[model samples]
Target: MLLAKVIGSVVSTQKSPSLTGKKLLLIQWVNADGSLPAQDQIRTEIAVDSVGAGEGEIVLVTCGSSARRVFPEPNDAIDMAVVGIVDSVSQNLSA
Candidate 1:
Protein backbone atom coordinates (compact mmCIF):
# COMPACT_ATOMS: atom_id res chain seq x y z
CA MET A 1 0.00 0.00 0.00
CA LEU A 2 1.07 3.59 -0.56
CA LEU A 3 -0.11 6.98 0.67
CA ALA A 4 -1.48 9.45 -1.85
CA LYS A 5 -3.80 12.41 -2.21
CA VAL A 6 -6.88 12.37 -4.39
CA ILE A 7 -6.26 15.11 -6.93
CA GLY A 8 -9.25 14.76 -9.21
CA SER A 9 -11.79 12.40 -10.70
CA VAL A 10 -12.05 10.56 -14.03
CA VAL A 11 -15.21 10.18 -16.02
CA SER A 12 -15.35 7.76 -18.92
CA THR A 13 -18.35 7.37 -21.16
CA GLN A 14 -17.24 3.89 -22.17
CA LYS A 15 -15.54 1.45 -19.81
CA SER A 16 -15.11 -2.24 -19.24
CA PRO A 17 -18.04 -4.09 -17.77
CA SER A 18 -16.20 -4.72 -14.54
CA LEU A 19 -15.42 -1.04 -14.12
CA THR A 20 -18.82 0.27 -15.17
CA GLY A 21 -19.96 1.51 -11.77
CA LYS A 22 -16.60 2.21 -10.11
CA LYS A 23 -15.37 5.69 -9.29
CA LEU A 24 -11.99 6.56 -10.76
CA LEU A 25 -9.77 9.11 -9.07
CA LEU A 26 -6.53 10.79 -9.99
CA ILE A 27 -4.01 10.55 -7.15
CA GLN A 28 -0.57 11.94 -6.63
CA TRP A 29 2.00 10.01 -4.67
CA VAL A 30 2.89 11.39 -1.24
CA ASN A 31 6.05 10.98 0.82
CA ALA A 32 5.98 9.12 4.11
CA ASP A 33 6.49 12.46 5.85
CA GLY A 34 3.21 13.67 4.32
CA SER A 35 4.94 16.01 1.88
CA LEU A 36 4.25 15.84 -1.84
CA PRO A 37 6.96 14.96 -4.26
CA ALA A 38 8.94 17.58 -6.17
CA GLN A 39 7.22 18.98 -9.24
CA ASP A 40 9.58 17.14 -11.54
CA GLN A 41 9.28 13.97 -9.55
CA ILE A 42 5.54 14.05 -9.06
CA ARG A 43 3.88 10.84 -10.13
CA THR A 44 0.13 10.66 -10.59
CA GLU A 45 -2.08 7.66 -11.27
CA ILE A 46 -5.72 6.68 -11.63
CA ALA A 47 -7.17 4.40 -9.02
CA VAL A 48 -10.58 2.86 -8.43
CA ASP A 49 -12.07 4.30 -5.23
CA SER A 50 -13.17 1.52 -2.95
CA VAL A 51 -13.52 3.62 0.18
CA GLY A 52 -15.51 6.59 -1.14
CA ALA A 53 -12.49 8.89 -0.87
CA GLY A 54 -13.14 12.41 -2.07
CA GLU A 55 -10.89 14.84 -3.85
CA GLY A 56 -8.18 16.47 -1.67
CA GLU A 57 -8.43 13.68 0.88
CA ILE A 58 -5.44 11.55 1.76
CA VAL A 59 -6.02 7.97 0.73
CA LEU A 60 -4.38 4.59 0.94
CA VAL A 61 -3.73 2.97 -2.44
CA THR A 62 -3.28 -0.69 -3.14
CA CYS A 63 -1.67 -1.72 -6.39
CA GLY A 64 -1.06 -4.77 -8.55
CA SER A 65 -3.07 -7.95 -8.10
CA SER A 66 -4.06 -7.02 -4.58
CA ALA A 67 -6.10 -4.14 -5.97
CA ARG A 68 -8.47 -6.48 -7.75
CA ARG A 69 -9.24 -8.38 -4.56
CA VAL A 70 -11.19 -5.51 -3.07
CA PHE A 71 -14.04 -5.79 -5.53
CA PRO A 72 -16.75 -8.41 -5.67
CA GLU A 73 -15.42 -9.40 -9.05
CA PRO A 74 -11.83 -10.27 -8.23
CA ASN A 75 -11.00 -10.39 -11.93
CA ASP A 76 -11.85 -6.73 -12.39
CA ALA A 77 -9.41 -4.93 -14.66
CA ILE A 78 -7.92 -2.68 -12.02
CA ASP A 79 -4.26 -2.13 -11.34
CA MET A 80 -4.76 0.26 -8.43
CA ALA A 81 -7.47 0.88 -5.87
CA VAL A 82 -8.11 3.35 -3.06
CA VAL A 83 -8.66 1.20 0.01
CA GLY A 84 -8.85 3.73 2.82
CA ILE A 85 -9.05 7.41 3.70
CA VAL A 86 -6.24 8.44 6.01
CA ASP A 87 -6.98 10.56 9.05
CA SER A 88 -3.42 10.46 10.38
CA VAL A 89 -0.16 8.64 9.91
CA SER A 90 2.59 7.90 12.41
CA GLN A 91 6.08 6.55 11.97
CA ASN A 92 9.23 6.20 14.07
CA LEU A 93 12.00 8.41 12.78
CA SER A 94 14.68 6.63 14.78
CA ALA A 95 15.50 3.08 13.85
Candidate 2:
Protein backbone atom coordinates (compact mmCIF):
# COMPACT_ATOMS: atom_id res chain seq x y z
CA MET A 1 0.00 0.00 0.00
CA LEU A 2 1.06 3.60 -0.54
CA LEU A 3 -0.03 7.05 0.52
CA ALA A 4 -1.07 9.49 -2.19
CA LYS A 5 -3.20 12.54 -2.87
CA VAL A 6 -5.99 12.65 -5.44
CA ILE A 7 -4.88 15.51 -7.63
CA GLY A 8 -7.36 15.22 -10.47
CA SER A 9 -9.63 12.93 -12.46
CA VAL A 10 -9.72 11.20 -15.83
CA VAL A 11 -12.67 10.85 -18.17
CA SER A 12 -12.80 8.37 -20.99
CA THR A 13 -15.71 7.87 -23.32
CA GLN A 14 -14.16 4.81 -24.93
CA LYS A 15 -12.80 2.28 -22.46
CA SER A 16 -12.77 -1.38 -21.55
CA PRO A 17 -16.05 -3.11 -20.80
CA SER A 18 -15.00 -3.98 -17.27
CA LEU A 19 -14.28 -0.31 -16.55
CA THR A 20 -17.73 0.89 -17.55
CA GLY A 21 -18.64 2.43 -14.22
CA LYS A 22 -15.32 2.94 -12.56
CA LYS A 23 -13.99 6.39 -11.63
CA LEU A 24 -10.38 7.15 -12.47
CA LEU A 25 -8.35 9.62 -10.47
CA LEU A 26 -4.90 11.13 -10.88
CA ILE A 27 -2.75 10.56 -7.82
CA GLN A 28 0.61 11.89 -6.68
CA TRP A 29 2.69 9.95 -4.18
CA VAL A 30 2.91 11.40 -0.70
CA ASN A 31 5.88 11.15 1.58
CA ALA A 32 5.75 9.21 4.86
CA ASP A 33 5.52 12.49 6.73
CA GLY A 34 2.31 13.28 4.78
CA SER A 35 4.04 15.87 2.64
CA LEU A 36 3.99 15.77 -1.11
CA PRO A 37 7.28 15.00 -2.76
CA ALA A 38 8.95 17.18 -5.37
CA GLN A 39 7.26 17.12 -8.76
CA ASP A 40 10.33 15.75 -10.48
CA GLN A 41 10.78 13.10 -7.81
CA ILE A 42 7.20 11.81 -7.98
CA ARG A 43 5.22 10.14 -10.69
CA THR A 44 1.50 10.69 -11.01
CA GLU A 45 -0.76 7.87 -12.19
CA ILE A 46 -4.41 7.07 -12.63
CA ALA A 47 -6.11 4.83 -10.12
CA VAL A 48 -9.61 3.39 -9.85
CA ASP A 49 -11.56 5.13 -7.12
CA SER A 50 -12.97 2.35 -4.98
CA VAL A 51 -13.55 4.46 -1.86
CA GLY A 52 -14.93 7.56 -3.56
CA ALA A 53 -11.89 9.67 -2.72
CA GLY A 54 -12.16 13.21 -4.09
CA GLU A 55 -9.62 15.70 -5.30
CA GLY A 56 -7.04 16.96 -2.76
CA GLU A 57 -7.83 14.14 -0.34
CA ILE A 58 -5.11 11.88 0.99
CA VAL A 59 -5.90 8.32 0.00
CA LEU A 60 -4.51 4.88 0.48
CA VAL A 61 -3.43 3.33 -2.81
CA THR A 62 -3.07 -0.35 -3.53
CA CYS A 63 -1.25 -1.40 -6.66
CA GLY A 64 -0.40 -4.45 -8.76
CA SER A 65 -2.24 -7.74 -8.27
CA SER A 66 -3.59 -6.60 -4.94
CA ALA A 67 -5.58 -3.89 -6.73
CA ARG A 68 -7.23 -6.47 -8.95
CA ARG A 69 -8.61 -8.22 -5.87
CA VAL A 70 -10.88 -5.29 -5.12
CA PHE A 71 -13.14 -6.11 -8.01
CA PRO A 72 -15.33 -9.18 -8.24
CA GLU A 73 -14.17 -9.96 -11.79
CA PRO A 74 -10.55 -10.31 -10.63
CA ASN A 75 -9.56 -9.76 -14.25
CA ASP A 76 -10.60 -6.12 -14.23
CA ALA A 77 -7.99 -3.87 -15.85
CA ILE A 78 -7.12 -2.26 -12.59
CA ASP A 79 -3.45 -1.84 -11.83
CA MET A 80 -4.03 0.69 -9.06
CA ALA A 81 -6.93 1.56 -6.76
CA VAL A 82 -7.89 4.04 -4.08
CA VAL A 83 -8.71 1.63 -1.30
CA GLY A 84 -9.28 4.08 1.57
CA ILE A 85 -9.50 7.76 2.44
CA VAL A 86 -7.08 9.00 5.07
CA ASP A 87 -8.52 11.08 7.85
CA SER A 88 -5.30 11.49 9.79
CA VAL A 89 -1.82 10.03 10.09
CA SER A 90 0.24 9.44 13.20
CA GLN A 91 3.95 8.73 13.26
CA ASN A 92 6.39 8.18 16.10
CA LEU A 93 9.44 10.35 15.55
CA SER A 94 11.47 8.60 18.27
CA ALA A 95 12.41 5.09 17.40
Candidate 3:
Protein backbone atom coordinates (compact mmCIF):
# COMPACT_ATOMS: atom_id res chain seq x y z
CA MET A 1 0.00 0.00 0.00
CA LEU A 2 1.04 3.59 -0.60
CA LEU A 3 0.22 6.67 1.46
CA ALA A 4 -1.17 9.48 -0.66
CA LYS A 5 -3.26 12.62 -0.64
CA VAL A 6 -6.52 12.84 -2.58
CA ILE A 7 -5.92 15.86 -4.77
CA GLY A 8 -8.99 15.58 -6.97
CA SER A 9 -11.52 13.37 -8.70
CA VAL A 10 -11.81 11.68 -12.11
CA VAL A 11 -15.05 11.52 -14.03
CA SER A 12 -15.50 8.81 -16.61
CA THR A 13 -18.67 8.78 -18.65
CA GLN A 14 -17.66 5.58 -20.39
CA LYS A 15 -16.00 2.77 -18.52
CA SER A 16 -15.90 -0.99 -18.18
CA PRO A 17 -19.05 -2.58 -16.88
CA SER A 18 -17.31 -3.71 -13.73
CA LEU A 19 -16.61 -0.11 -12.80
CA THR A 20 -20.08 1.27 -13.46
CA GLY A 21 -20.69 2.89 -10.09
CA LYS A 22 -17.12 3.32 -8.89
CA LYS A 23 -15.58 6.65 -7.97
CA LEU A 24 -12.17 7.55 -9.27
CA LEU A 25 -9.75 9.86 -7.53
CA LEU A 26 -6.58 11.66 -8.45
CA ILE A 27 -3.88 11.11 -5.87
CA GLN A 28 -0.34 12.17 -5.22
CA TRP A 29 1.96 10.19 -2.99
CA VAL A 30 3.03 11.97 0.18
CA ASN A 31 6.61 12.74 1.13
CA ALA A 32 8.36 11.37 4.22
CA ASP A 33 7.15 14.37 6.21
CA GLY A 34 3.52 13.52 5.37
CA SER A 35 3.31 16.53 3.10
CA LEU A 36 2.37 16.73 -0.57
CA PRO A 37 5.10 16.83 -3.15
CA ALA A 38 5.59 20.06 -5.10
CA GLN A 39 3.23 20.64 -8.01
CA ASP A 40 6.05 20.56 -10.53
CA GLN A 41 7.30 17.30 -9.09
CA ILE A 42 3.96 15.62 -8.61
CA ARG A 43 3.41 12.19 -10.11
CA THR A 44 -0.35 11.93 -9.93
CA GLU A 45 -2.30 8.70 -10.31
CA ILE A 46 -5.94 7.60 -10.52
CA ALA A 47 -7.31 5.23 -7.95
CA VAL A 48 -10.73 3.68 -7.52
CA ASP A 49 -12.32 4.92 -4.30
CA SER A 50 -13.10 1.94 -2.09
CA VAL A 51 -13.23 3.78 1.25
CA GLY A 52 -15.23 6.87 0.33
CA ALA A 53 -12.26 9.19 0.82
CA GLY A 54 -12.83 12.79 -0.20
CA GLU A 55 -10.57 15.42 -1.69
CA GLY A 56 -7.84 16.77 0.61
CA GLU A 57 -8.00 13.58 2.65
CA ILE A 58 -5.02 11.34 3.27
CA VAL A 59 -5.71 7.84 2.00
CA LEU A 60 -4.16 4.43 1.57
CA VAL A 61 -3.82 3.16 -1.98
CA THR A 62 -3.35 -0.46 -2.82
CA CYS A 63 -1.83 -1.25 -6.17
CA GLY A 64 -1.48 -4.07 -8.67
CA SER A 65 -3.18 -7.36 -7.96
CA SER A 66 -3.88 -6.47 -4.38
CA ALA A 67 -5.99 -3.55 -5.45
CA ARG A 68 -8.19 -5.70 -7.65
CA ARG A 69 -9.13 -7.79 -4.66
CA VAL A 70 -11.44 -5.11 -3.33
CA PHE A 71 -13.93 -5.70 -6.06
CA PRO A 72 -16.41 -8.55 -6.06
CA GLU A 73 -14.80 -9.98 -9.15
CA PRO A 74 -11.09 -10.65 -9.19
CA ASN A 75 -10.93 -9.62 -12.82
CA ASP A 76 -12.00 -6.04 -12.20
CA ALA A 77 -10.01 -3.56 -14.26
CA ILE A 78 -8.28 -1.82 -11.41
CA ASP A 79 -4.62 -1.37 -10.78
CA MET A 80 -4.99 0.97 -7.83
CA ALA A 81 -7.70 1.55 -5.24
CA VAL A 82 -8.15 3.81 -2.25
CA VAL A 83 -8.52 1.18 0.44
CA GLY A 84 -8.28 3.22 3.62
CA ILE A 85 -8.74 6.71 5.00
CA VAL A 86 -6.04 7.93 7.34
CA ASP A 87 -7.07 9.68 10.54
CA SER A 88 -3.53 10.11 11.78
CA VAL A 89 0.03 8.92 11.30
CA SER A 90 2.35 8.45 14.24
CA GLN A 91 6.05 7.71 14.38
CA ASN A 92 7.54 5.71 17.19
CA LEU A 93 9.89 7.80 19.33
CA SER A 94 12.15 4.79 19.82
CA ALA A 95 12.52 4.31 16.09
On lDDT, the candidate that comes out on top is 1
Off by over 4 Å in 2: none
Worst 10 residues of 2 by lDDT: 68-77
Clash number by candidate, in order: 0, 0, 0
User: What lDDT score is found at residue 9 in candidate 3?
Assistant: 88
TM-score for each predicted model, relative to the true structure: 0.91, 0.91, 0.86
The local distance difference test score of each candidate is: 0.91, 0.89, 0.87
Predicted candidate 3 versus true structure: per-residue lDDT over 1-95, tens digit per residue? 88999999888888887777888899999975578778887789999998889999999999998898887773378999999999888877689
The regions of model 3 sitting more than 4 angstroms off are 38-41
lDDT of 2 by residue, 43-78 (tens): 899999888889999999999989988887834688
Worst 10 residues of 3 by lDDT: 68-77
Q: Distance (Å) between predicted and true CA of 25, model 1?
A: 0.5
Q: Considering only N, C-alpha and C atoms within 3 Å, which residue pairs clash in candidate 3? A: none
